[model samples]
Target chain A: MRPIVLATDYGTSGAYVGQLKSAIYTVAPGATIIDLTHELPEFNPRASAYLLASFLEYVPPESVIVGVVDPGVGSARLPVVLEGDGYTFTGPDNGLFSIVARKLSKARWSEILLSSEPASNTFHGRDIFAPVAVQLASGSTPRLAPAPAEDRAGIQWPDDLHEIVLVDHFGNGVTGIRYRPSDQERIMKVHGEKVRYAPAFHCVGPGESFWYGNSNGLIEVAVREGSAAERLDLKTGDPVGFDAAG
Target chain B: MRPIVLATDYGTSGAYVGQLKSAIYTVAPGATIIDLTHELPEFNPRASAYLLASFLEYVPPESVIVGVVDPGVGSARLPVVLEGDGYTFTGPDNGLFSIVARKLSKARWSEILLSSEPASNTFHGRDIFAPVAVQLASGSTPRLAPAPAEDRAGIQWPDDLHEIVLVDHFGNGVTGIRYRPSDQERIMKVHGEKVRYAPAFHCVGPGESFWYGNSNGLIEVAVREGSAAERLDLKTGDPVGFDAAG
Candidate 1:
């Protein structure tokens, strides 16, 4: 059986995910459709890209990964399939595969121009990417779809360090910092001040703040029994800094 | 936020899935835990094995897949962590990963000897596997805990031709055939006659019997707007046969 993972910005409240699954199953009856996440924050391609890149490696080889964060559904934005390292990615030409391609040894891409079919202005997830993914999962070659346009721009991660891309459900601000146990013995510096590590989110003394590298390889700031984002007045994209000192 | 996928046979009725997620979040604060499926049949390792082997590739790579379908929880059974390309799988040592490992390269297995701790007999999904999965999600090493023994016996797919593993929500008896479209196109010679394929479950001719693959990839025998399992005296695990032709 073939496995297909779907990552989309479509929230779970609608028929978007269901319709897409039905369409795929319509074409490939044996295909196992896995929902990576339909709850990606709406139309946030960067967020979608990060979420996809972080989890793409776990999918089995030969599995088709369908990403539909397309804000440019019916526009000139091209639908593309990136094939590499025993896996395939199908999504809009928007930089969805850029981060993914960086992680693989080899990647070949093709653009999907199936826009001539009757498609909705609002839902390319159901119309475009979903069908293309079904075809791929059914053993159709990537090149069988429309050829990808040459010189199309791929996505790029920000390098200026001006914003952080994640916030916890409890509103704790986290940065992309890989944590190590050795760092625990050292004094942690966040935003230029020495801080202590809390055992749990609430382990810090009341009103006392701290920083630690969370399991997801990110630096998280939290306040005991309180909202850290509220206490620090931090939002999702706010910039922060940290350093470990002996 | 980090994504964690839960795969279990606990079925979605009780507080099992909810409590597992609560325990996970309590340990790894602010993490987003996704329920892959709680609808797996109870205590059926082969079904859980097949389901996980089929769908685990669709989840994000860093996501922790927590699978609990153990029929031998508090006994000599072992909790295990199997690390493979881009994903981590936590479950009992009942051969859940055996099917998946055959399809992947370089699987690192570790036994979680957490049985020595205070644990529950009925709910290892909540006590052992869930907590260990949270620690794993929080970036704990698999070797952090006592090493579980390796080379445990794996699950064997039932060789009996007529065995059924699941009866879905719609009362469709899902057989082990794992149907594909090619199989659906070819008529199955059953009971000394060719059984024609019905386009949909309800597409069977009036007062006629039909069989076809349902949307979830299981071969189903059904009558239009009727229960074929009941009419045909078919219960789960009963042996049934279809000619290889279709």
Candidate 2:
């Protein structure tokens, strides 16, 4: 079985993540589970979509990603399985898989039909999606209905989000803007502060805040040894606009 | 090969943890890494010791437990590998493994001698401990020298601690005390306040605080649908003394 990459809003200290792994182990005992992350910004599938897309490029190829940032858990939102390039995503159809779908155009997708199996209305991520993720990772054909490529029901959001999508443990806010890396000075204006871009933390002065293309190839705001969010008083979903002076 | 369980103070939002797992995977390609927890309170090995001991029972048997809460990382403090009943631990010998050593008495231990291998002066958890952890998990006996169990250097702490060892994300404070389950009105006094115990959250009134034996069999302070740490002004290592009228 290919590895299962678990990405969820289930905080690390909690029991939910443990149960998710237990679920996978019970079904696919030979499966390997890698945590892409669990401390995803709570209940924001749009942001998780980009993060899932970004992480897909870094993880093991042919890996099955289980993305679960579902806020509309018990709602009428459909559950989904997005088959990206050499990777698979299992989550809600709440636009969580949309960016991943966009990232790999040749991607195939399907909707998990409504089920009567015992599950909590608020935690389908565990009861519903996790079991299906194991099935996919275990090389079993899960019950899936085709979701056409043109079906943009969950993907009404913009292609490249301008808002802050992720705030890391160090309080570095990762923006949704994708850019190529270069030594040339790149700058982004957030709120009223101009964040200069550097290639790495060493290139910037101590305690200096800068934007850089991170290991994941996305523009990120960071401080050399301090917190970028704290220094700039930034939060997720805050806008980062192009620097006019640049 | 048994699984590799990572217990560290390395916060999740940083690159350190990803890099740590990356280091493990580079050496032990088949190793399945389970993050026992990362958001350990920074640099307090006493609490981390108890937490590590508590987690040992919950993880997979015969697993390699890589514990690192090294405040004295680059110092002359020895690095050690403890072989437990059915598990192994590799980390700094700065009392991080003391509780686990005490928990399983038949355990054997060894020291990883100062080596010529290139290592970071600061980040030894990544440079030194993670690689050793991978070696243990990958069924390789890393070069280890005999260290007597009677060596009182790290195991001098009390068998059962009386102070708060951990304060978790939900603001619940976990103490190093243990107790049996019963319906009796258990009580604990802290900071001139008498805290009564309840079995589950539902047993206590909403927003009321209580002490109980948590899942890992340690006493914990929690508020039902509220922040116990915030309300009680609790931090790690704060005193949680015994019940007087028990």
- A126-217, model 1: which lDDT tens digit per residue? 77777877777777653445454345455346422323445544445555344555667565444445556654433445566776654334
| Candidate 2 ranges beyond 4 A from true positions | A13-31, A114-120, A153-159, A202-206, B2-5, B12-37, B41-136, B139-246
lDDT of 2 by residue, B77-189 (tens): 78888886888888888888888888885888899865665334445776788778877776776788998877735678887888888889899999987766662475787
Scored by lDDT, the top model is 2
Candidate 2 residue pairs that clash = A169-B13
Report the Cα lDDT for residue A228, model 1.
67
Instruction: Give, for candidate 2 chain A, the lowest lDDT window spanning 10 residues.
Output: A178-187
TM-score of chain A of 2: 0.94
- Model 1 residue A24 lDDT? 82
lDDT digits (tens) for residues A41-133 of candidate 2: 787877777766766555667778888888887888778888867888888778877877887858887988755763688777778888888
lDDT of 1 by residue, B2-107 (tens): 4788888755432245446545644554567788887665556765565566565577877788887775554676778877787888888887666666556877
Evaluating just chain A, the predictions reach TM-scores of 0.75, 0.94
